[model samples]
Target chain A: QKEVEQDPGPLSVPEGAIVSLNCTYSNSAFQYFMWYRQYSRKGPELLMYTYSSGNKEDGRFTAQVDKSSKYISLFIRDSQPSDSATYLCAIGGTYKYIFGTGTRLKVLA
Target chain B: EAGVTQFPSHSVIEKGQTVTLRCDPISGHDNLYWYRRVMGKEIKFLLHFVKESKQDESGMPNNRFLAERTGGTYSTLKVQPAELEDSGVYFCASSQAPGSEETQYFGPGTRLLVL
Candidate 1:
């Protein structure tokens, strides 16, 4: 089975709408969960990360990890056009770094 | 301090040509990593370096690709007789260590187009 799975969504939302992105993993050994944002032609940038199961909030971004369910999520509150990009969910197992096919997010102004 | 930097932001070469992509990690970082994203696929790890030593290279696709981190500094990934399937965006990232919490800074990435 694939280690991590995410919907490759071209999800469009009106500006100011709340955006939620999610991923599910099959490995319980994954202890590190993270969200990265990538703009065209640029590399992925670390948005927020959480260890194990917990919710971390940074400004308008919130990252939640549910270890029991092997699920994780990133929520962007008060989204704006500047928030448009590809959102990638990454998980780290003991030996490898696994990433999901990113969800393309567009916050239309 | 400058973030990770990669050379030749984009390269377009025909199959069978060799292409060398370079990455300069942030100074003082002891860990370096290489990842690639093919069209319609997720970004995948290729290999990782600790100083001049390879910590793990299990993700490398095959023998056609070779990566070197000589003298514990800048690194290079070379693809000989590149295949059309080898086209992708190659990203280089570095971190102080592989802790559960340390941030991995990324380079601008080099786009390789093998036609």
Candidate 2:
């Protein structure tokens, strides 16, 4: 099984809508969870990260991790056109870190 | 203090040719990583370097790929006889230390196209 699985969504939403992106992992050893945003022609930028099962809020972005279920999510509240980009979920195992197929989001103005 | 930076923002080369991509990590960072994203695929890890030493390189696709970090400074990735499947965006990242919780900062990435 792939270490991390994420829906490659070209999801479109109106501005000010709340967006939820998620990923699942089969590995139970993953302790670090992160959300990264990537713009066209640019590398992934760290959005928010959580160490364990819980929700972390940073401005309009919220990252939640459920280690028990091996699930993680990134919630964007009041999303704007500037939030239009690819969102990637990453998890770190003991030996290495793995990334998911990013979800492309377009917040239409 | 600059974030990670990569050179040759875009490169288009014919197959079987050689290409070298460079990366300058954040100053004072001890941990550097190389990643690649093929067309329509997720970004994948290539290797990890600790200072001038290679900490882990199991993600390298094959023997045609080589990476180096000299003097614990900048790093380079060289692909000899590049293939069509090798076309992808190459990303370089770095962190202060492997143990630290600080997130890895990424470069703008080098977009490589092999024809």
Candidate 3:
């Protein structure tokens, strides 16, 4: 089985809608959970990072980690068209990183 | 300060050809990394460099691929006699602190197409 699994989504949402993206992993040793945003032809940018199972809030984005189920999520409040991008979930050790297939998001005005 | 930058934003070569991709990490950053992603696949770690030394290179796929970070400033990944399966985007990233690496800044990867 793959270590990390995420649904490849072309999820579409209306402007100002709440968007929820998620990923599940089977690796119990993973300590770092991160979310990244990527635009076309650009590198992925770190959006949310968590050290363990818990919740973190940053501006309009919220990240939640549930280590028990090995599930993590990123919630975008009042999503805008400008917020449209590919969302990637990544877990890593001190020296290496593993990524999940990203979910493509589009917010229409 | 500018983020990491990669050269030859895109490359197209035939199978069995040699291709070299370059990465210019952020200045003063001691940690450099290489990664790749094929079409519809996730970005993957290929190797990590600490200045002029390779701290971790376990992710490299095969002997046909070679990576070097000389002088601890810029790095290069060369694929000799590239295979059809080698067609993918190669990325380079760097971190600010040498210890407990965090928030790796990535370059606009070099998209490679092997025909």
Candidate 4:
């Protein structure tokens, strides 16, 4: 199985809606989870980062990790058109990161 | 401070030709990484460099690919006799340290098309 898996979603939502992005991993060794936002023609930018399990919130974004299930998620509250982009989940080891096939999201105005 | 920067934002090369991609990491970052994303595939790690030394290169596809970081500054990845399957977006990232929790800043990426 691939180390990491994510839905390649072209998930569309209306503005002010809640958006949830998720990823699953098979490696139990991964300790750090990260979410990245990538716009068309640009590189992936670090959005949210969390170590181990639990939740980390920054402004309107929240990242959650469940080491027991090897699942991670990024929640965007009050989504805006500006949040329209590809969301990528990354599982980090000692020196490398395994990234998922990003989910493309579009928020309608 | 400036973020990571990659050169030749886009390149189109014929199969069996050669191409070199360059990356300049954020100043003082001790760790550098190279990743590639083929069409419709997930981004995959290629290698990691700590200063002028390669800390890990287990993800490199094969011998045709070569990466170097001289003077512990900018780094380069060269593909000799590139194949059609080599077409992909190459991303360069740098982190302040080698730990798993350190945030990695990525460049705008080099979009390569091997025709």
Candidate 5:
């Protein structure tokens, strides 16, 4: 199994909607979970990250991790067109990071 | 301060040709990483460098790919006799420390196309 898995979603939502992106992992050793935003032709930018289980919020973005289930999620509230981009979930190990196939999000105006 | 920067934002080369990509990390960051993302695949780790030393290179696909960090500064990855499968976006990231909790800042990435 792959270390990390995420839906390659071109999930579209209207403005002011709530958006949720999720990823699952096979490695129980992963403790650092991160969410990154990538626009077309640009590199992945770190959005929010959480260590172990529980949620970490920054402004309109929230990241949640469940170690038992080996699942992680990012929630974006009040979505805007500016939020339209690809969301990637990364699991950090001792020396390297395993990234998931990013989900593409498009918020309509 | 400036973010991570990569040179030759885009490159297209023949399958058997050689290409070298460069990465300049944020100043003073001890940890540098190389990652690649094929057309439809997830970004995969290539290697990690702590200063001029390679900390881990388990993810390197083959011997044809080589990476180096000199003087604990900018790094470079060279692909000799590049294969068609080597086409991908190469990303470089740097962090202040080696731990998992440290945030990694990334470069704009170099998009490579091997024809």
Candidate 6:
């Protein structure tokens, strides 16, 4: 089984909608949960990072980690057209990083 | 204050040909990593380096791939006699701190196509 799993979504949402992205993992040792945003033809950039199983709010974005369920999520409030990008969840470790198949999001104007 | 930078933003080579990709990590970053993502696949780790030394390379697929980080400043990944399966986007990342929680900054990957 893969260590990290995420839906490969081409999820579309209207402008001003709320967008939710999520991932599930099997490793209990994972301590850091991170979300990265990747635009077409560009590298992924860190958007949200959490070290605990709680919610972290940053502007219009919120990252939640549920260690007991081994699940994590990123929520975008009032999504905009400029928010179109691929959201990737990464599990960080000392030796390697396991990345989820990103969910491609498009916010229509 | 530059983020990681990768050379040859894109590459196309005939099967069995050799290709070399380069990465310049963020200055003073002691940890460097290499990853690849094939078409429709998630990005996968290739190797990790710490100050000119390879800390872990278990992700490297086979003998045709080689990576080197000289002086722990810049690194290079060379694929000799590359195969069709070697086509992918090669990404390099660096973290200033070696801790597991340190955020890693990634470079725009080198998209490789082996025909």
Report clash pairs, candidate 3. Answer: none
Worst 10 residues of 3 chain B by lDDT: B96-105
DockQ of each two-chain model: 0.67, 0.61, 0.65, 0.88, 0.85, 0.79
Error of 4 at B105 (Å): 0.9
Q: Candidate 2: misplaced stretches above 4 Å?
A: none
Candidate 6 deviant stretches above 4 angstroms: none
Instruction: Please name the candidate that would achieve the greatest lDDT relative to the true structure.
Output: 4
Candidate 5 C-alpha lDDT tens digits along B4-79? 9999899999999999999999999999999999999999999999999998899899999999998999999999
Report lDDT (CA) for all predictions. 0.92, 0.91, 0.91, 0.95, 0.94, 0.94
Clashing pairs in 6: none
Off by over 4 Å in 1: B99-101
Angstrom error of the Cα, residue B11, model 4: value is 0.6
Q: Which stretches of candidate 3 lie over 4 Å from their true place?
A: B98-100
Model 4 agreement with the true structure over B1-115: per-residue lDDT tens digits = 9999999999999999999999999999989999999999999999999999998899999998999999999999999989999999999999987867698899999999999
**Residue B63 in candidate 3 has what lDDT?**
95
Better model by DockQ, 4 or 6? 4
Give candidate 4's TM-score.
0.98
lDDT of 6 by residue, A1-109 (tens): 8899999989999999999999999989988889999999999999988889999999999999999999999999999999999999999866578999999999999
- By summed lDDT, the worst window of 10 consecutive residues in model 6 chain A runs over A89-98
Which DockQ-derived CAPRI band holds candidate 6?
medium
Clashes of 6: 0
- lDDT by residue for model 6 (B20-51), tens: 99999999999999999999999999999998
lDDT of 4 by residue, A1-108 (tens): 889999998999999999999999999999889999999999999999888699999999999999999999999999999999999999997878999999999999
Q: What's the TM-score of chain A alone for every prediction?
A: 0.96, 0.97, 0.97, 0.98, 0.98, 0.97
Considering DockQ, where higher is better, how would the candidates rank from best to worst?
A: 4, 5, 6, 1, 3, 2
lDDT of 6 at B114: 99
lDDT (Cα, tens digit) per residue for candidate 3, span B42-105 = 9999999999999888999999999998898999999998999999999999987653347688
For DockQ, candidate 3 versus 4, the one ahead is: 4
